[model samples]
Target: MGRRRRRKPKWVPERAIVGELDRRGRAVVAAGEDGRPREAHVDGALPGESIEYLRCDREGPVDAARTLEVLEPAPDRVAARCPHYGVCGGCSLMHMDPDAQVAFKQATLLADFASHGVEPERVLPALRGPTWRYRRRARLGAKLVPGKGKVVVGFREKDRRFIADLSTCEILAGPAQGPLADDPGRLISALSELIGSLSIAARTPQIEVSAGDRELALVLRVLDPPSAEDLDRLRAFAAQYELRIFLQPKGLDTVAPLETGRELLHYGLPDFEVELGFRPTDFVQINAPLNRAMIARVVELLELEADHRVLDLFCGLGNFSLALARRAAQVVGVEGDAALVERAQANAAANAMTNLSFEQRDLYKEPGAFEWPGGPFDRVLLDPPRSGAAGIVEHFEAIAAPRVVYVACSPETLARDAATLCSRHGYRLAAAGVMDMFPHTAHVESIALFER
Candidate 1:
């Protein structure tokens, strides 16, 4: 007899059933197409290999098991370098392609508007900067382990309470890079020779590296006062790096120099020839390039003219006021912090700007008697903190500037405030778009132009 040919096994179409059986007695569990009980399958069976997913529909929640396919990665899928990408909460979308991530953010804004019965005619393409290693500010948690006899500083892990063992964070800017990245554990161990104990703090824990046009400043937020030996090591590190070191002990009030002979720590805005000096604990935007871009965008939105007067709300150290003074007839900056107001005034003087003024006001609180700079003000620029300008929206409405440009860091607050301004104040959202200020993180920085 001729040799019998064997038939080739057919390829399964993802939902194919492996087998079926009948039970004469006893309870029989619903079987999946892979011949395994639906609950017993792992990875939910290979892709294309049967796995029925039963849905409650038509028959009203039947017990019969149905085969379903496994979920696959999205089309824009790309590999991320961080070991803690999915598990670590720090960078939520690092796995996504950077370009796609920007597009997704833009799409989200469009979706938000479409739902609100408004469509923007133009959206400036996302103002993108270096996507990776661009963070100039970070607050790191400092934990001391007795076994290790040192401090561990970095961002915490997503799933676990403990910090991730990261040596170099790709998300931090180059100036913010630490020796720890080469060998984090070993580096912390070495630092023990100088420091005593550590505890939780802000985003970038040990050395807060604020960027500038010329020099860099490293502000160290020490939970406890540094020991003599520690100070010496730090001084040596400063000398080695040729960096200015500021010690922050308790709070913003406690930030000062260790041994002063050198110049004060300040970052420069060369475009406006303005220098801003801030303590490490003070709030400053993390991304420098984008910050410059944002400030420029705010100025451009103001549509400044030689004779126009402008108001800058929550003006921190005259960032916008000075920029406005360059073009407008006069600029008034109002801030809640008296110290910041003083600093703003000093900054104006430092830059030799005459048309800028600063005032201290608790804009968030209902003041019994308050003063507003006399104005038929041509335009108003507001950059309030995350809480939004809820307390002063009426005053803003009262002023009734023909144009208002708002720079916001929170979308929900911005949306609420924008809605109020539009419905109550009669200003329309003329243009708005997200800025990639804090990339790889969920933080959204946006700007909007409102016109009557």
Candidate 2:
């Protein structure tokens, strides 16, 4: 008996072109289907590019079309450097020019600021670094596809949760297995080959990749334990590449080195004469050069005086706090993660930073819950996550630091928190700008200084 064939999706306007880019950098396509103007977003498409995509029968909150073909590209559109551009969800702005990408991110940040009824007194130039191979940390997805008889390792698809078949990645830092140069081609392929040879390839769900100045570590998340042969292969693979290999059976605390003599993942800020140690699961800035530049900018903006006391909130592993300690008289770094707080303390001690102190406090909770800190600080630095520093913004009087610098990963949340600070805390948005922490993606990392 013959089986029913799959039906094609009901895509509209067989001939359509993207008119412009939206605030989020998405390509916006306006089409008049059945004489009614309809709008939909085309993925992997640049503005002024003609494209073809699948449109389902019913539209979603934001109608997203996939499998796009750029018939006539935009003037500013450039060929994607990554071979797995469209399939891999790691990057969405590779087709757009790098300078344009930075501008788009800046515009996104500024628009958010304007929407929240706040504006920066001065707009700083976008902070940028190398356009390629800047990502030093990533959690790659792993899956064993049926019939393929091998493991597929890469980022998930742009529209789906399935892993993209990736042989190499351009944005990711190359794992230096031995003495050879950092080659992107060998990194993903070697990881794929290693996992495919394992008995528990299907049971492995993730590979947490992180690279420090001299160390590149991979932590394999295993659902089930591997056999004796699997351990031999893993150990050999680790030794061959001279890569730090770790295994995680369940929780993050369970992650351990596969072999002995594993050193703590380390990086250094030469400008500040500071070195930091971190675990593979710890949150560090993806772009090292850009991070150093950012810390410099933050220090310059704060105009840290030798007699001033500074507060660094959400200071993970003392990345900024360490740098600030080099300039400020006293620096107090607070983070919610106890583990990171401990790491920060160790880093401060290792650097012989007597002026810096590390503390653990959930900055997201009520500010009155804790005995806060010795504040009325001269300067305050907030490096919050995507949720922003909403909880503490209300009780700004507790710290009431005259000068506050906020480093944010989310522009919308930054704008929201800026509104709270300006309206209630008597702070003015002094200066603001973005940093290309993750290029070729919509992720915007911005820094703002507030003055009272």
Instruction: Give Cα distance to truth, residue 200, candidate 1, Å.
Output: 14
**Top lDDT model:** 2
Q: What TM-score, over all chains together, does every model reach?
A: 0.75, 0.93
Each model's lDDT: 0.62, 0.85
lDDT of 2 by residue, 292-403 (tens): 9999999999999989999898998899999998888899989999999999999988988799888898887777565657766999999999999888887878888889
User: CA shift at 56, candidate 1, in angstroms?
Assistant: 26
Question: Residue 29, candidate 1: how far off, in angstroms?
Answer: 26
Clashes of 1: 19
Where does model 2 exceed 4 Å of error?
A: 1-9, 31-38, 56-59, 175-180
lDDT of 1 by residue, 288-369 (tens): 7777777788878778899999888899878778878888899988899988888788878887888988888898787324
